[model samples]
Target: MGAEQNWIPTEIGPADVGAEATPYGLIDHLQRLEDLTGLLTREKALVFRGFGVTPGELDKVFDLLLPNRLAYVHGNSPRTKVGQNLYTSTEYPQEFTISMHNEMSYAHQWPARLAFYCEVAAETGGATPVVDGVRWLAALDPEVREAFAGGVRYLQNLHDGYGFGKSWQQTFETDSREEVEAFLAGTEATWEWKKDGGLRVAQLRPATTRHPVTGTEVWFNQADQWHPAGLGDETAATLASIMPVEDLPQSVTLADGSPIPAEWVEQIRDRGLDEAVNVDWRPGDVLLIDNVLVGHGRRPFTGSRRVLVAMSD
Candidate 1:
């Protein structure tokens, strides 16, 4: 199915951005958009003018801005940075249309919501893209879909062996091997370690999860299960050595315990990349995206494309 053909009508208030004494004050004024969207239920996108508000004052609003308050918001400023580091991480800021995938899919824990704000529009490309995760979930194969419904069984390598960033241990507040081991011990999963000491083996989570809002189950495994320690680094390497990462025993049906084919799982990725909607950004444009219902990404780019992110509880 395509995007709901019926456009959810939205009323736009005055673009006049009033001065806010506190960051929350800006939210009070911004609340109108929240109310109009039924907490943003009506439409997936919105743009704000800032009513000629000063950039300095806007900074104050940013201080008060909460991830739950807005999924994404773009300011009028021409300069902003989206990711912390793009080059060493393979995470591009403004390159091409990003594949439609949920943020932090590799992490056992994920944010419920995501937001993007456009500070300035690029002269050429640079557009925010999105896909309806629910729509994709509904179209998945019955057998394969059932497997994902079983829940996601995944492991993330705490080490940045792939060169994404510092080791996962460094990124966390506490990265002690003992602490990590303790966290792994708390889960019910099968695991093993890699030949090298770089990664650990783990299987501490379910194979799929039920969406609290829509009650729909989607393929939660994106890229976490294929890592070295995520699926028993040795097991993953062995599987990768012999078979493609997609063909591994990543998902199983809860009802019959049947396995989901790798090809079927890839289809979900194909749908996300093919059916996603692109959001071309402009300066002073504020956009909110439903992380639970939507998946997003952007292609690599040349110039500086800055965007800020905040998570919703």
Candidate 2:
């Protein structure tokens, strides 16, 4: 995490590959690469800049980068689906920074790779910050890491059709209760239906995971994002004033259901952001990352910004 060891995404420009700065030329360059996946595993992240890739031409590029794109099922972020299995990056407010976390790391299964396309760059800020999971883990205090070694328990309270946060239908991207149950049946999660037409789900997941290819263990949980302490003090206080802790939209605790200290979550949130390297966006730039090896977040911004994301297993 030090300056000397800071890792940034490898940038591949048109000139780097000896190609024209156009979609067709970029496609040709990618087609000639023999081991794209292996290259990604070693680099952790690759940023394609100065290619002038347009929305109309994104399909071909995405097909080469993220084959077999996945739907954002069970995703917690608020995003608009704009194309086949493609979504606008989290619709969080532009004035507040989004802390780093691996996408869906709290779930039983998560994507192996993530691709982000910047369609409209913000006038200021709005850089996507990514952190190496290994460095992130190293940056945490030993006590904090030890506390999470027992794993973490995540709870979600999704309303039937209206309430705080997302509803079950929107969360699972389905209207059928039976289908939702069927999906949950395949995972080690437990759920209950509330009298108020809401659903409560509880899941126990490891705090860290190993990269399938490299066998590198890294910090891989969303405890900070889910914990009230991770929300700024003002937000956490406001939510506490309105409802009981258990009634919050989401909560996290130790796997044995023990409360995690507020200071620990604060440290977790701050350290990840501290160790991150930002990827500034430019219109038509695409970034691909090995999801398990890196965690990503968004910085607060001014002016309009539009970034699309897609994932593949």
TM-score of every model?
Answer: 0.62, 0.98
RMSD of each: 7.8, 1.3
Residue range 179-292, candidate 1, lDDT tens digits: 656654644434444454444443433444556755654445453223322333365457668654333333222223333354654566566556666666555545555555
Q: Pick the candidate with the highest lDDT.
A: 2
Error of 1 at 112 (Å): 1.8
What's the lDDT for candidate 1? 0.46
**Candidate 2: tens digits of C-alpha lDDT, residues 39-125:** 999999999999999999999999999978999988888999999999999999999999999999999899999999999999999
lDDT agreement with native, every candidate: 0.46, 0.93
Give the TM-score (vs. native) of candidate 2: 0.98
